[model samples]
Target: MATSKPQVSPELSKHYSARMVAVFRYGSLAIAGIGFIQAVIFAALGSWVVVAMELSAFVGGLAIYFLIRRGHLAFGILAGQAALMAIAITMGLILDVPTADAPRISHLYLLVLAALGYLNYQRGKSRAQLVLIGLCLLAFIVLASAPLTSPFVVLPDMARTIGTWANAVMATTLLAVCIHAMQAEFNRKDKFSRDLMTALWNDEFQLAYQPQVDLSQNTIGAEALLRWNSPKRGAVSPVEFIPQAEELGLMVAIGGWVLEQGCRTLAEWSKNPLFRHLSLSINVSASQLMHRDFEAFVRDTLVKTRANPHRLILELTESVLVTDIDLVIAKLDGLRELGITIALDDFGTGYSSLSYLRRLPIQQVKIDRSFVQDAVNSSVSASLVKNVVLMSRDLGHTVLAEGVETIEQHALLARFGCIEFQGYFYGKPMALADFEQRIEARIKRLA
Candidate 1:
């Protein structure tokens, strides 16, 4: 709400305008329906003036609906309706009907106006502040004049009878509109979540391999990245759907799938002697790493796929490892004892990547692309990266500099003692087949 762009808010707030229109339309229908019911009650009691007022409310609500639908008078309609309600309550107070009824009606109207004002403020619609001020002033005037007015003012405040009904109708309308908006939002998210679930089952997610070339060792390795091709959503990013998968209790299953796919790719590559020594790395989420059967999953997948566990690498971000250092260390040790390697992905971006680097059983550290991409242009980034590369190499760990998109970055990192590199300078992530062809060609050229 503080930001100028309301459309950029939460999922529900992004649809605030549409929700407001719905509220107006639904509120209008509610007002008309309640007004008609009031009219019938007054007709039985022979109260013509009260009937007229109720009928007026119904017409006003109808007019507001049309105004909003036409994209005209949106601001005026919301402000005018609140103003009119306040005026009606003020009139009721002036007419000294009964201490019990007039004041209660006035207070009820004030509360309803406040509710509308708060919603308007959150929505940040046009003229909401002015409208709130006007409503507040109206309430003050009604309360202030309640004592000074003459004993008999007008038609004995017939609104007391009608006010109760109108208040109830408006309250119910507001409540229903909010509930409807929330339900609509959930339904929208549920659709995508369902698509993701179905996609997981239908084999819609695939892996892309980015080579992590260890220049000093003259060896090739790769990091496996997940890509989702949803039939409904079309190329949904991991940023958008992976968290949803995690929240839906599907990460363990999805993570297992990734592990198997990466190992299967490794198995295929093993046929080509040039690619046999390459480390095939796949990312592991915190949830997956902490999973009770994660180690077993890795062992079983490697056995079934006939993929060499010695050549398999499991990558975890710095923050993921810091969740519980002991658990991470134990897990990494167990996997390493099986001849599998553990990598610290996106290092230097986390608060304590360095602090825990020595503590964890990590074999390699990948300097985050953010540091490399900006290092050429930013002195601070370059300094941080230099320290990281130097410190990591000194620790006897395989240091990889990722996102080395230029000859200069690759040359600079190699000079900085970073033995490994991955980025556009070498090659982007590619399908297993494409990468195999590239490896074969590079090997042939060198021979």
Candidate 2:
């Protein structure tokens, strides 16, 4: 792979990072603030020791926040908080912070702190951070329970009875709060992810076609391309987002949608006898091919749009062939049986390029743009294209040279026995309606 310079603006990247930090800091502060308020209320109700413990926790949290802000905090912040919690519990026991009337509140505070520590640990992105947080939470839980598990049971006194009831209430409240917090976080993250996808779907992602003309007739034969649009970002280039969508598991849906749209457009165009000979080609992502229901989806879309399967060409990248040679060949064969022509896109871009020619059920080879762009200036590139074209011809596959941006380049390709060409020299991509008008005008002029 070619190593390219970073494409994102440095300022934008920095701003994004800063925003994430702010969210993390504010989220932590909010949790601490709630704990502090609860402690104050409990203290006012005559549970001074519990209030003191809560205050200590609040102070510890603030210290952690500062350390994080300064970029000096280690993963040990969780451990440190757990230690402070332990110390608070010990002091409470020594002075009897929870009276006979409210032993339950003290237990609730300890349990809630432990739960918070556990959540902090689980939220850490790295394994090291997670382990540190887990240990801290564990320590807090152990320390908080040490006194309560003492061998000597307090006599069945009023103070003991009140403490037991308070502890029960505190446990119930803590459990409820933790459950609500977790549910809210899950819902928030889910909504954010869904919104991001929706925005991407509506954005300026679009398909551009390279006309595949027949060498014998010198007329436009077909248009092969895919569409992608993003709302926030304008025109996310396929070369940039295709791989990302595959990695992020969004390609199947996107690719299927593109297929349906392309087929429907082709069916609409086919109504004109002038365009009857012009085929439509759509690129399929590896993720889409790997889906168990892909073939069925393609069949259903073709039926729904009433598009001729023979006129719909499906293009697959060489990367897909490389994934599992036998599987790809089998899948291509299935598509071929449905009368859908298969083209190997970006033919020479991957490893084992020559191997795919013999193994896959490909009917056409679209020479990658890189070779076409360099063919005019470099003999090596020219020779590579010549060999690929010759090889495809020998295998009874049609060859289409992509990115033919100059007349000289077009002339050179023609000299090398290359037939079909598509690039900016003819015309950049236009809207479907504009393209149709151009086609009509060209036909009229020729007539």
| Runs of candidate 1 exceeding 4 Å displacement | 1-181, 216-219
> What lDDT is obtained when candidate 1 is compared to the true structure?
0.69
TM-score of each: 0.62, 0.56
lDDT for model 2, please.
Answer: 0.63
**Residue-level lDDT tens digits of model 2 in 216-258:** 3344655645544545445544444554455457778777777
Per residue, candidate 1 scores C-alpha lDDT tens digits across 1-447 of: 000111121223323445565665666666667657766776676767657766766676677666655555345446546754754564455532345554444344344445454555544444655566476656646664555443543443554556555655665556565556656646756886798889889999988877778764344788788888877778766655676777688889998888888888889878877788888878888888888999988889988999988898888876675577787788889999999988888787675555687788888888888889888888898888899987877777888887788877877777777878888778777787887788788878789
Question: TM-score for model 2?
Answer: 0.56
Cα lDDT for residue 443, candidate 2: 84
Could you report the Cα RMSD, in angstroms, for every candidate shown? 11.9, 12.9
